[model samples]
Target: METFTEWRTWERARADLAARSLGPDDLVVLDRAVDAALRWHGDQRRPTGAPYAEHLFEALEVMVRGAGVTDLDTLVAVLLHDVVEDTDATVSDVEAEFGPDAAELVDWVTKPPAGGQGRQAKRVAKTAYLRRLREAPPDAIRVKLADRVSNVQTLDRMPPDFQRRYYLETVTYVMPLIELLGDDTGGWFSGWYTSWRRRFGHLG
Candidate 1:
């Protein structure tokens, strides 16, 4: 499913969210989450040199447009998923701003500085994070799966080593979570990623 994952701008994404059957409070929360993300991620760039908000927008679009997700808190958490991990923001800061539900979901998906110093430590930390995702609530897993879909959708743009490594990580840990969902939407995501993996046959 080549669903449109790029909103290109937050205004465009906001418009799409508005077009949905959301109420005033939903719009307000979404707007605040977008503004907060813009402020906290100011001047940051993705590895591909794109504006950082582009990634957040892509994740939002994946959940909303691609996965048919409409939960207000999940959408909000998707918007701010990386803030606590990448910025100086804390879970408490998120809780103060967006309340507990969003904060807890974000915390579940946030990768801590778990393993410590070296490259091996970093790998261990990431591995642990992925493995621990098994215990995440469904909405939190939805956030993560959408985030990963956005990241992996452009795999051809990354280096070969990164592609293989990420593909392995995705199939090994991430796809299983989708399988656990045991529903049609989850099957759709799993199929889409499986086709993505097939497209880049070298990942096999």
Candidate 2:
């Protein structure tokens, strides 16, 4: 079944890890990351009306269950990835709390500022960001690949025109990163993109 849901609570995250045979050390990092994400993103909601934390949880699920990632820093980075973009949180703040590795991964996935530009300029900024991903560390690329997977899972809720533009952007910008993201994880993201195109082709 598709993993997209309205929200994922801490209990659900615990259950997901337990099912995957991740150990206590994994649990500790994930718990701390989740707590921090909630503390920072309290009351924020995605455009789809889901609590913002669900996006982070789903991205972690993609990394762990879908990509078989057990790395603590990678998982923690997924949880805090959007904090810098959506909140007042900074890369230094994340580094101070979770360490340099997580902060770096978050930075790789974080989109640079568009300077309050219009849609076209924002697209240009995103294109530039995707190009930079080609040079990012492998784990950082994986985090972004997983992030795209989570984001696309809810794409159907978007307006038709927006869906068309987003699908095109994914193909043009994100598809090339598959090689940088490595085989298993990259393959999953490719499959999601392909299937999403077929499912939403009319919008495109």
lDDT of 2 by residue, 1-204 (tens): 355452377798788687778898778877888888998898999888988888888888788777778788998998998989888889999999899999999988888898666988887787888888889988888888778878887788888877888877777777778866666767776776677667767765
What overall lDDT goes with each candidate model?
Answer: 0.88, 0.81
lDDT of 1: 0.88
What is the TM-score (0 to 1) of candidate 1?
Answer: 0.95
Worst 10 residues of 1 by lDDT: 1-10
Q: Can you list the residue pairs that collide in candidate 2?
A: none
What does the lDDT read for residue 33 in candidate 1? 96
Error of 2 at 91 (Å): 0.8
Task: Give the TM-score comparing model 2 with the true structure, all chains together.
Answer: 0.90
Q: Highest lDDT, which number? A: 1
